[model samples]
Target: MVAIELKIGSFKAEYAGKMNLYLSLLDRFERGENENQSIGIILCADKDHLDVEIALQDINKPIGVAEYQLLLSKEELQTLVVNEIKASTKEEG
Candidate 1:
């Protein structure tokens, strides 16, 4: 299971706590007996590496923090699509 949380601004320490709660709930109540532990992903518009490190330092569950662009340029989107196609083709080949 994967739980994703999206934020519009910079990452905050509280976000990590919130994700931890979600992960805990999922793991305790929703996860299957044989399923792998749930993973959490927090996506923010901006993040500081140090802040992320500090926030996640003591976390035992699998969680990832990443920055996301609110809007990508047309060219950027096209490039991403092309790259995705190439990746899929390679996988199929």
Candidate 2:
């Protein structure tokens, strides 16, 4: 069994605490339901590597932290398209 937590902003200590508790609870209640040991994953928009390290140092559970990417904003997409068009035009000329 696996538990995944998504965070919009950044990694924090409290998140680790919550994950620890949740994993512990799952172990207690969902025992024998999952063949393998339960795992937790934290997906955040942005995270500080050091902060995540310190947050999970004391905990005795399996947890992983990773970052996720959001779709580009309208303005950013438009800018990229415009740049591509300009570059193409220059190459053709």
Top-TM-score candidate index: 1
User: Global CA lDDT of candidate 1, please?
Assistant: 0.95
Candidate 2 structure quality by residue, lDDT tens digits, 1-93: 798999978888899999988888888888586466779999998999999999999998999999988799868979998999999999999
Q: What is the TM-score of each candidate against the true structure?
A: 0.75, 0.72
Question: Candidate 1 lDDT, tens digit per residue, 14-65?
Answer: 9999999999999999999999999999999899999999999999999999
Pairs clashing in candidate 2? none
Which stretches in model 2 have alpha-carbon errors above 4 Å?
72-93
The worst-scoring run of ten residues by lDDT in candidate 2 lies at 29-38
TM-score quality measure for candidate 1: 0.75
lDDT of every model, 2 decimals: 0.95, 0.89
